[model samples]
Target: MFRPLVAAAAVAASFVVPPAAAAPTPATPDQSASAQQVRSAVTELAEGLSLEEKVGQLFVTYLHGQAADEVHPGNQRDFGVGTPAEVIAKYRPGGVVYFNNPSYDNIDTPQQIARLSNGLQRASRVPLAVATDQETGLVTRIGAPATQFPGNMALGAGRSTRDAERAAAITASELRAMGINQNFAPDADVNSNPANPVIGVRSYSSDPALAAEFTAAQVRGYQQRWLSRDSVSATAKHFPGHGDTDEDSHTTLPVVDRTVEQWRAVDAPPFEAAIRAGIDSVMTAHIRLPRIDPSGEPATLSKPAIDLLRNDLGYDGVVITDSLAMAGVRKMHPDAEIPVLALKAGVDQLLMPVDLGLAIDSVVAAVRSGELTEKRIDQSVLRVLRMKFLRGTLGHPLVDESRVDASVGAPQNLAAAQAITDRTITVVRNESLPLKTTLKTTSALVTGWGETTTRTLAGLLGGTALPTGGTPTEAQIAEAVRAAASADLVVVLTNALSKQPTQQALLTRLLAVGKPVVAVAVQNPYDVAHTAAPNWLATYSYGAGSMAALAKVITGELKPSGRLPVAVPGPTPYPIGHGVTW
Candidate 1:
């Protein structure tokens, strides 16, 4: 499934210069000092911690109100709880995972987000390494005229390594301004199928070499922490390779049939590249790779898989598991057993452990019973401490409360989102006029399929909602068919923020209409690629910025300059990697 960006050598990518970020008033640890002073702060913080506290530093937690007394957000009540400080202080959580939702969402402009994040940092006992899954070109938390960026396969399309590198650097810079330090991105999963239910647009390519190169460049660009170099760290994900599976791991456990030898040569390349380039973290996917461990459990709970990451790939960084509650491991593996297996399997820290007290009890019990060794626990703790040590978060003094407003989304952050959106718009199939100069008729049908894509396209494209039942029912399809027969064009949208199943249905409906349908895959090229209609433009992500880019590309405001990152197999019954330029 991995496809290499085979373009001739040339630097390629887009840049969005943003307003200078105001430095957070040097409150607690005085970040405005020389390297020596910062190092001194780090050292002072590091020297006093016991091994238990040190090991505790590696764990990352959600800012949700897991506790009973936590104050709930008035809007989006169930989304999460606690401010950044509460999460850090209560659990002594090493870091915080920034998840998007109706509450505390990342959909805000980057400037707003940057200031919000600054407030979060000030609340932290230590400078918690802020994290999010902002893989450019697909699955971004940011949006807007600053929005559009191509996914990995699009970068692979131009065979341009420089494009991948620049996008990575840009993504890092934007996030840094907003105060996010970790990006669990540039999915190294080598997507072999255009129909791969989950990993398609997110993966770099099915070609291991290409995945490796793209991932390497992306990490370097995202990691330049000092000066102009973006200080944000990169976390290459789903370590033992998840792209080959056709099944969706979010709902079901997707198993890969490849043998260890096969994976070593194919699936392991990008991780190898990431490690070589000095990445900070490696997040595991909820995938089952049997050959690696031979144990019945998925790769996440398998010792061989985690050990291979260390001994085989030589990754000395922290190894974190995907959400514990995700279906892949939750239903099959009882909650009590998950943490133990992960720890024994060599996973350093558990993420979103819903049953925290139980998890801690289980691990502690394992140690008391000699089921798990103290030495192993110490090693894991050491890894956690080392990482925080590197981040300069170990022993910084308390952050001030006065500067809380300084951190919301930052301008540079929003600019980066807009820049990527502008560059990642790939015009896959353009028939009549490459870029339609005029709408001809404003009465187009707008169907919102994915979450992020809908809001963006509706506002930018100026299309009438596909009536009340836009869910694409049988009646809706019939109506759409009749409308397409008479209307100027039919415009369908899938979330440019995250790809989902609804996008699949939307494409099927448009294809059934059998009319001149211009589809925008706000998610990934894979969203629209699976159904090869006459006109398909893939934005690779659904950010307001990216959606704006899509509208621009459709109307010739921004040229359709990007290429597909991964191959969108034509009609599939044919083969993967199928693409014919218009």
Candidate 2:
């Protein structure tokens, strides 16, 4: 069972650097203009910074408060030594990552987030590139009042780069309106393994080519100034790929035991395509590939892996580390040491360092002790400054707080999200779908893990809303069976039934009822394979827009056109890209 959808719970110009050769061959007109501008800004900014300030430019830490564990429904005005604003003022960090999670109580609304970002920029001498993970569907950190679209898998199901582009464009437009310039999104990893826990629906597809197309489209959308004058740079994440592992890096280091040839054929293409499309940054995965680096260090701390990204794939733009606080990286080194090692490993930005002050100080100390050179520090700082310059953050640091309401969650954007989501409803097994019956007289029984689906079904089909408890018991299943006896059709909505034993048993009971049943998977598409229902649907997400699309398909208002983005391996073979139309 998963959370409900639509219901409950849950730059510049300036100086020039010395040429390597006198009168070197010139770069192309259009492409070299922006590259030259970045180089000029980086050289200028780097010249004006102290050693401590230069070191700070390489680290991006979490913006959390003293009372981080407590929930403050209102604005938290405590900008002290360790606080977010205080960290910016003291360390002069190049960037700061924002989180509105339950553990931290800083952000409650878009206006509050805008205020926080604005305040941090005001405190800093160099405008920090305020960043956040705005990966629309399951990973949306920005709460309600912002338009939440279906994620990459949903977009992949739609099988349209145009939809992927439009969704990302809309996302970037809203993020820029809120003053955030960088989005850690458009996951380029191929979901090659069905058992992969972390990146199931986060990835676009199992097929490398399909994922590559969507990733490139998303990168273009995020960078497109034509979509919105206010554009947010997209980061293609978990590089060298985080889609084939069974382990989660948050808890333990994941290992991808594939040879170079295998990785090239499967996981490397999407990242290559994203780089070609000019993505702003590529975040390193904490996962290890023994075939690539026999030293056994995660990609975030592996120089070989970094070289592979830089020289092999030819991705020159900022190489960011996946949060150093994770167990994958932290288990290998202490908080103070992560900064120095990450920089030495060729990471341009040390993201979410475990200890903010210690990380900055250690990098400075590392330079002094010959552990890292000043030139190495300058290399990363230059990239960071280049990103800020390219994003126009140096020119305009603060956001207009008043525009939070009018700009984000605009009606047109939400409509586009719903339309895109509607296109991702893959009907894997539809037996005379669209009900093929008159709705008003039909006695329909709707049941699911949460109240949202039941409520939605009742509103749509005049059905009995039978909401199941999380991991239902025998009694609940019996009650559902009794209800299904008199129903013309039974609609079962599931989140992840494969993992939920009680939900699986409930499905077994529903099948025994001998009624016309339709099973809809609201989260993982694999649930369709576990149930005996002849009609199976995959919304690919539980977002409001995703559910709205599902509702339209159920009522025959819209045709089900989405295909399976990832392969669902079971007794029934539902290959990636398999779909059924109305």
Model 2 TM-score, 2 decimals: 0.91
User: Which whole-number lDDT from 0 to 100 does residue 323 have in model 2?
Assistant: 90
Candidate 2 displacement at residue 273 in angstroms: 0.9
lDDT of 2 by residue, 387-463 (tens): 66656676667788898888888998878877788889999987767867778768888887778757776666777
Off by over 4 Å in 2: 1-34, 65-83, 225-229
Assess each prediction's global lDDT (C-alpha) against the native.
Answer: 0.61, 0.79
- How well does model 1 score by local distance difference test? 0.61
Residue-wise lDDT of candidate 1 within 253-317, one digit each (tens)? 88887887998888899998888776767888788777665676777788878878988876767
Model 1 poorest 10 in a row by lDDT: 2-11
